[model samples]
Each structure stands twice: as structure tokens, then as C-alpha cells.
Target: MKKSIFLLALVIVFSSCNNTQKIAEITPNEIPSGNYEIKSIQGEPVYKLSFDVDTSENKISGKTNCNSYSGTFSLTNNKIEIGPLSATEMYCEENVMKVEHSLFEAFSNAKTFVYDNNMFVLSSETGIVLRAFRIVKK
Candidate 1:
């Protein structure tokens, strides 16, 4: 009985550790420069959306599940702004256009960024977070 209880306790500890990780809030200087594919927005999954951010040049470019887009971004302290965005004129489905519009709007609202273990998060002042994973360049 004692051995079983000890084993149970050990299992619980490891399981909890795996589920809860220590996330480090990062500054603009600490933000890694790379292409990121969006996994979710505000905890809802987003498919076929990705972007590349160049911290050195303050440039951003990406696809919106339809047309290609390019923009300038500025990161100061904890605040981020992505605006003056330009995209190809290719017409996509109305549903896709709506989603793309919301995403760019979210970028304009981004306030803080954090590195959550395996994910990168850009959050807004109003509590919206865009979670993405790094895209390994070949």
C-alpha cells in the first residue's frame, strides 16, 4: 500500500510538470527573427496563415490564406504595431477575406509578446493573442 501510494504521487508530479510549463515574457530585442505559421488566434485554430518578421529591417511579409501581403512593423518596448499593410489584389473567397481582415486588425492592436515554451504569442491590449510556431527555413 505504501509503495503504491508513493508511485502514485511520483506519477502525478511528472504529469503536472508536463502540463504546466514556465513561460517567459520577452522583450522586442529578445524576439527571434523568423517565419512563423499561425496555429491559433485567441485560442481558436487558424489554418494556412503564416508570416515572416525581420527585426533588423522592421519589415513583415506573409500570406493570408489567399493573397500575399507585405507591411512595416515597429516594436518598441512591449508594444508592437503592424500597419500600412499592402496585399496582392487577388480575390479570395468572402469567408477568407473576412478572416484575413480580422488578423491584420489584431496586429494593429498587439501590445505584448511572450514566448510560451514551444509557442510564440503576440497579444493585444484587449486580450487577443496570436499563437504561432516557428517555421524552420531550409
Candidate 2:
């Protein structure tokens, strides 16, 4: 009886851990299509950009205040790849440029991303969190 009880407890623990791991794994298909606004980075207000994902084109495009940019994106097994980003050279106001630069740097360096409900978060291997909010359609 004691052995059976111990086995049951172990099974329960293992099952719970598996569920948690699954929850943490978010797929790109789960990400909604819409505009997302940068909210905070590492728990601080940083830069804001609007990201519009075009699944048909397998691209994510938007404006970062300083310029308009677009990039091809792919996801496999919950892993994200964003690259080949191309943008215009038009300049903007000082504040806008600052924000745009910050946003661009963050996106360029993002190693992993997760989309949860209305929030899309980017994180690095070291666990830095960059949060964004989905813009409501008007």
C-alpha cells in the first residue's frame, strides 16, 4: 500500500510539471493577427511600436515612429525566427527616434517570444521580459 501511494504521488508531480511546461510553450499559430503596441521592457516604459502580422505573407510589418519596416517570420515547435528586416530611411522627431531606436534594438535582439491572450512578450535566454499589448480594433 505504501509503495502504491508513493508511485501515485510521483505520477501526480510529474503530470503537473508536464502541464506547466506545455503552458510555457506557445506556438506562433496561437498568436493573434492584429496590431500590438510595445508597453514596457524589463518592467519599465521604453518604446512603442505597432506590429501588424500578415500570416498570408508570413511577415510582420509595422511602423516604429522613425520609419516603416517589415520582416519575414517563421515559427517551428514554438520557436520564432524574425529576420531580413528592411525599413525606410525617413527620420523623425528626437523623441520618436529615441523610442524607435529602442524598439528596433529590442526586436533585433529578441531571442524568444510568447503571446498570451492580449499580451505578447519577448524574452532573452537570460530571462529579460519585454511586454507589449494588442491594440484594440476601432
Candidate 3:
């Protein structure tokens, strides 16, 4: 009887551990579309930088250190592609140009994005590229 009880408990335990629970993927259609105020790039803090995302139109526009940039982008299965961008030709200070260089590096690489906890994070395979919070419209 003890052996039979042990077997029953084992079956119950095994049945309770259901490995079939599906994790829903955030589809491209669900990618947030709006203006996100960037707070950091390459894990370094910065201010006065932001991106305007229009997912429906596959467009991204934002400010660099001294230039206003526009680009095409796509998001699929949380992976991101930002690029082929054009920007205004205003010369900036050295510090501002440094920030723009970092921004361009992040823009010209492989990236993945996540919108969570009210924060939008763009990351590369090595580490985080930038982090931002969406500007909610009132």
C-alpha cells in the first residue's frame, strides 16, 4: 500500500508540473508607438535626447547632440533594425559630438528592444544601448 501511495504521489507531482504553459511573444503589432525621452546611451546617462516612434509607418525621428535625425526602422519579435538615417548638418561642441558618435554606434548595430515597467530599453548583443521612458500624452 505504501508503494502504491508513493507512485500515486509521484504521478500527481509530475502532472502538476505542466511544462506546456505558453509564453506570449510581443508581436510587432504590439510594439509601442510614441515619443520616448532617452535618458541614457551605452549605459551612460544623457539628457535632452528623445525618439519619436511611429510603428505603423515604420519611422523613427529623434534628436542627436545637435542634429535632428530621421530614419526607417523595423521591429520583429523584439529584435530591432534602425538605420539608413539622415540628419541635419549643424556642427556641435566636442562633448556633444561624442554623444552623437555613441548614438550612431548604437544605431548602426544589431539591437533588440523591450517596453516594460514603463521603460523602453534598446540593447545590443553585448549590452544595453539606450534606455528611455515613453512620453505619455495627457
Candidate 4:
């Protein structure tokens, strides 16, 4: 009888351990997965920049004024790593070219992300490089 009781207790303990591990595997800091409109770049307000994030697939696709770009992204807690992005090659005005270059550089240097009050901010080691607002679809 004592041996049977010990075995049952051991099984319960193992089950509990497994449950705790499963909970730990669940990430508490989930990526904000949705469409967002770019609000600013390098602290300056901007327009016409937007992106969509799919956390389930770790993908990011966006429009950069004159061109559309798609890329893979990975998030580890608050840290974000945007993979090499591919964009359509199209001729554009000088100003638009600058904006596109800045956008791509920002993604390359992005190190951290912050989402608060429906606003999303992407930052590098130096400081914030991009700020976006979550776009809610009707």
C-alpha cells in the first residue's frame, strides 16, 4: 500500500512540473499583431507609411510611400529583429527616396519595440527611430 501511494505521489509531482514548464513556455510579452500607420520617423511626424504585422507567422509587410516591402521578423520579449526586407524597385522623387532609405535603415537598426496606449514605438540603441499607431479595422 505504501509503495502504491509513493508512485501516485511521484506521478502527481511530475505532472505538476510539466504544467509549470508549459506555462513558462508561453511568452508573457506578446507582439502586438495588427496593422499600424507610421506616425513619425526620427521624431518627425510623417504620413503615408504603414505596415502589417503577423505574429503567428513572424512576418511584416508594408508600404513605404513609393514602394512596397515584405520581410520576416522575430521578437524576443521586447527585442525585435527585422530580417532583410525586399522591396519593389521603382523610380521616385528625391524626397521619397530619402524616406525609403531611412525606413529601411530604421528597420535594420531596430532593437527594441514599445507599445503603449495603442501607440507602437520602434527604437535602436541610440533612441527612437520610428513611431506608429495601431490601425483598427472596422
Candidate 5:
């Protein structure tokens, strides 16, 4: 009877450790803790696209192809909302303006986020709109 109890205790301890490991696996995929640069928009790479988020302050700022912008962001669980961004009025070529507009639309419509490895993807209900890669700041 004592041997059976010992075996049961060992099994319980191992199971607990296994559960903890599973939780740890998920922790890395959470909202990343540093700056990230916008790598793509709607599956197309855009020039000079950058993004930064401060999870601690629930704020986000970025530069599009033509202008710099800043805005507030909210995150609940995995859902994300960024909006009401105000940007500089400096004008640019028509193509650059178009890309900037697309970037703003993506951010305004963002509904959720996915983080894997060093990549962060922002998606709307329709589909992914932005993909960003983490930047390790020195």
C-alpha cells in the first residue's frame, strides 16, 4: 500500500510539471514586449513602414510611407483596437500617399493579433492586414 501511494505521488508531481510546461509554451506567444517594424501590408511589402507599441501604456505609434502618426491602442485578451490616429499633413507622391492610407486603414480596422516566433500579425475580421517583425533594440 505504501508503494502504491509513493507511485501515485510521483505521477501527480510529473503531471503538474507537464501542465506548467504547457502554460510556459503559451507565454512566449503573448504580445511581444518590444518594438516591431511593419514588414508587410495585405500580403504586400511596403516601403518605410514602421510600428511601435507600448503594451504597458496601451499606446501605439508608427510611420507610414508618407507620414508619421500616433494613436492609442487597446488590447483585451488577444483582441486589438487602434484608431483615431493623427498624422502630419506633409504631402507626398500619390503612390506614397496611397500606401500610407492603406496602413492607416489596417490599423484602424485591426481586430486581433497573432504572435509567433518573432513575427506579429494584425488582422481584421476579413483577414490579415499587417505583419510586423520584432526589433531587438540595443
Candidate 6:
């Protein structure tokens, strides 16, 4: 009886570990489709920038400040890639440019994203989170 109980406990522990690991993996469906807005930049508040994600075309197009930028993006289990972003060359004030640069860099380097309900959070490998809100269509 004691041996059987010990085996049961071991099985329970292994099963729990598997469940935890699975939770860490990001599923494809967790990524939302449609428009989004940047609610925060690098864990700080900033002017909202709208984003439109086309999962079918594997593209992410968005408006940052007064400039529009588009780029290719890919998302897999626990991984995200946004790169090769092309934007208008129009210049802006120093403060606005700083925010634009930070947003662009953060999005470009986002390695993972977590979405719950209509709220989306993008994070880098180092755990910096950029939160965004889903834009409801009229």
C-alpha cells in the first residue's frame, strides 16, 4: 500500500510540472486580430498609437505619432518577431521623436506577447512589458 501511494504522489507531481510548462507556451489563438492601440510605452504612459494587425498576411501596420509604419510580423508558440519596419521620413520635435524611437524599438524587439480579453501586453526577453488596448470597431 505504501509503495502504491508513493507512485501516485510522483505521478501527481510530474503532471503538475507539465501543466505549468504548457501554460508558459503562447498559443496562436491567443493573438488577437484587428486594431490595437499602444496604452503604454516601455512601462510608461505615452500618447496612444494605433495598430492594425493582419494575421492572415503576417503583417503589422500602425500609426506612430504622426508617421505611419508597416512591417512584417510572425508569432508562434512563445515567440514573436516584428521587423523590417518602414516608416515615413518626416521629422518631428525632439520629445515626440524620442517616444517614436522607443516605441519602434520596443515593437521591433518584442519576443513574446500576452493577450487577455481585449488587453494586449508585449514583452521582451528581459521582461519589459508594453501594454496596449484593443480598439473596438464602430
Top-TM-score candidate index: 4
Cα lDDT of model 1 by residue, 1-138, tens digit: 999999999999998888865755554345667888898876678888989888788888898878888889877766677778998878889989877877777777778776544467788877856888878555
lDDT tens per residue, model 4, 7-101: 99999999888764332232435556789998888887888788999988999999887899999998888898997999999979999989888
- In terms of lDDT, model 2 sits at 0.73
The alpha-carbon deviation from the true structure for residue 116 of candidate 3, after best TM-score superposition, in angstroms, is 1.2
Q: Residue by residue across 37-83, what tens digits does model 6's lDDT show?
A: 88888888976677888877988888777688999988777578888
Per-residue lDDT of candidate 2, residues 1-138 (tens digit): 999999999999998887643333435546666788878765568655568877667788888766999888776645567777888989889988767666666666677777767788877666655688888665
Off by over 4 Å in 5: 1-29
Model 2 stretches astray by more than 4 angstroms: 1-29, 46-48
Lowest-sum lDDT 10-residue window in model 4 = 20-29
Give lDDT tens digits, candidate 3, residues 21-122.
784554443557788888888889999888898978999898876989889988777888998889898999999999988887887774788887558888
lDDT measured at residue 7 in model 2 versus the true structure, 0 to 100: 100
Which is the winner by lDDT between candidate 2 and candidate 6? 6
User: Local error of candidate 3 at 122, Å?
Assistant: 0.8
Residue pairs clashing in model 1 are none
lDDT of 5 by residue, 64-137 (tens): 66788988887777888887898998899998988888888999999998888778999999999999888865
> Which candidate has the highest lDDT of all?
4
> C-alpha displacement of 48 in model 3, angstroms?
1.2
If the candidates were sorted by their TM-score against the true structure, best first, what order would they fall in? 4, 3, 6, 5, 1, 2
